[model samples]
Target: MNNAQEARRILRAHRYGALSTLSKKFDGYPFGSITPYLTDHDGSLLILISTLAEHTKNIQNDPRVSLITHDQRDPHIQTQGRVTVVGDAQPEPEREKAGQRYLRYFPEAQTYFAMHDFSFYRIRPVAIRYIGGFGRIHWVNMNNYAVADAEAFVQQEDALLAEVNARSSNALCRLLQQRHGISAMEAHAVGIDCDGLDVYHAEQTWRLDFPETAGIESITESLAQLLTATP
Candidate 1:
């Protein structure tokens, strides 16, 4: 796939990133914070922050921000793939909807979501920097990195994962082995988007991309087909 698509793949596979905001307290300097984010279908990022948070305050003063996420599986940091999203953060009024989407990826944050101090901020990306590997880096345009029909699989994710783990776990493990050459004793489906599936196995997360983007019905069919084709 292209660099933009590859960057989105990396973002889809990972859950946390380093968020940098213009420091409101430090004379407009950049302040960095470790944050967990969820991507919307339109390529924006959703971050939950408390009113007391430093980054939150920073964003209020200056909406311009940047977030960077890289592959953790790779030991050689310089050679690993990573993406940087430069954007503007604004309050997302749809808290309930954003909470539903965020909690699915970070269920542990439920308590935080219930608190009145916490709020959801949506970061609309203006530009993206995607580094695929050593010497394979390029700046990807927002239009090229956009995810179409993110809701296609997101709405059905919970039920779909339950079914995959219950009935197709073995097949998924086999598919993992077939593609990555690593055998996982047990695999749990953590997330799925139009482009790929995220499988948690052996205490690590693995991404397996589809041959093509998949919709709700096609995703199930694709997994079944992979199971039979893997051998």
Candidate 2:
């Protein structure tokens, strides 16, 4: 895969990151905090933070921010794959719409989601730094990194998920077991993009990369091919 796609895959595989925002109280020094993020369909990030949070206060003063997420499963941190997003964080106007998708990945945040103080912010990346491993690093171009036809995928995601879960759930289970070597009683597709599919099973999310990048028009066929190939 290209550096951009590889970076996106790494981001999709992980959930939480260290968010650094300019501290408003500490004379603009960088303030770091752990935050959970959801990768939006368009490759931006979605983070739910309370108004009272230090990062949120800093963001209100200065939207500039950066977040770094690495492969937590790897014991060797320095050489493991990681992606750093340098971006601007802005309030997401569509609360309910964003909340629906965000909540699916973070159901435990239900209480925070309901509170008035909590709100969704979208971190639109200006540039991305991707480190694949030793001797593999690149500054991915935003033009090549962005997902095309992202809105189409988002609009159809709920319906597509329902259809797949209802009719092809067994295929998903088989795909998970055959590919990841994990057998589970049930499996469901939580998200799908040009790069691959995200499956939730056994109380954890697993990412399955497609053999080839599949556009919105061809995603269903691509998934079917993978499922058919998996025994």
Candidate 3:
């Protein structure tokens, strides 16, 4: 896959990142916090923050921020793929839409959503840094990194994933074992894009990228090929 596609896939695979902001209290020093993020179909980042949180305060003072997310594998972290997004964070004016997608990924946050103090913010990326592995690093322009046609599949994502997890459990397990050698007894599809499936296998997650990107219309055929491929 190209660097842009690889970076987008990595972002979709992991949900948490280290958010770095200019500290409001520390006199311009950088402050970092573990933050959970979800991507809008166009590649902007969505984060839920409480008014009382330090990161929220920092963002209010200065919109400039950066977030880095990496693969969560057990191997050496330095060698794993990672993506750093540099952007400005601002309150999402149309927050109901953000809430819908964020809640799907983090349902437990429903209580926080009900609270008045919490609100969603969208980060508009100005630049991106993607590192696939050693010697595979590059600065990707915004146009190259964002998926322009994501709208074609985002609305149907949840239902598509639900059907796969519910009726195609064995196919998922087979793909996981054949690709990663992890014979997971239980697995559920957590995310889906035109490119691949992200499966939550018990405590760990596995990303299964198709041989080629599949549009919404061809997803069924793409998945069927994997299920029937020689292991």
TM-score of each: 0.84, 0.95, 0.86
| Residues 1-231 of candidate 1: C-alpha lDDT, one tens digit per residue | 778888887787777899999998989998999999887656689999999999999999999999999866678889889999999999999999889767766778999999999999999989999988879989997677876666666677778778877887877788789887887778877766677777777655667777766666687877666557745
For every candidate in turn, the CA RMSD to the true structure comes to 2.7, 1.3, 2.4
Q: For residues 35-92, what per-residue lDDT tens digits would candidate 3 score against the true structure?
A: 9898666778899999999999999999999999986664779888899999999999
Which candidate should be chosen as best, given TM-score against the real structure?
Answer: 2
Residue pairs with backbone atoms closer than 3 Å in model 2 (clashes): none
What is the Å distance of residue 114 in model 3 from its true position? 3.2
Candidate 3 whole-model C-alpha lDDT, 0 to 1: 0.83
Superposition error at 228 for model 1 (Å): 3.9
Residue-wise C-alpha lDDT for candidate 2, range 2-29, written one tens digit per residue: 8998898888888899999999999999
Put the candidates in TM-score order, highest first: 2, 3, 1
Which candidate, 1 or 2, has the higher TM-score? 2
lDDT of 2: 0.89
Error of 2 at 69 (Å): 0.6
Worst 10 residues of 1 by lDDT: 222-231
Candidate 2 root-mean-square deviation in Å? 1.3
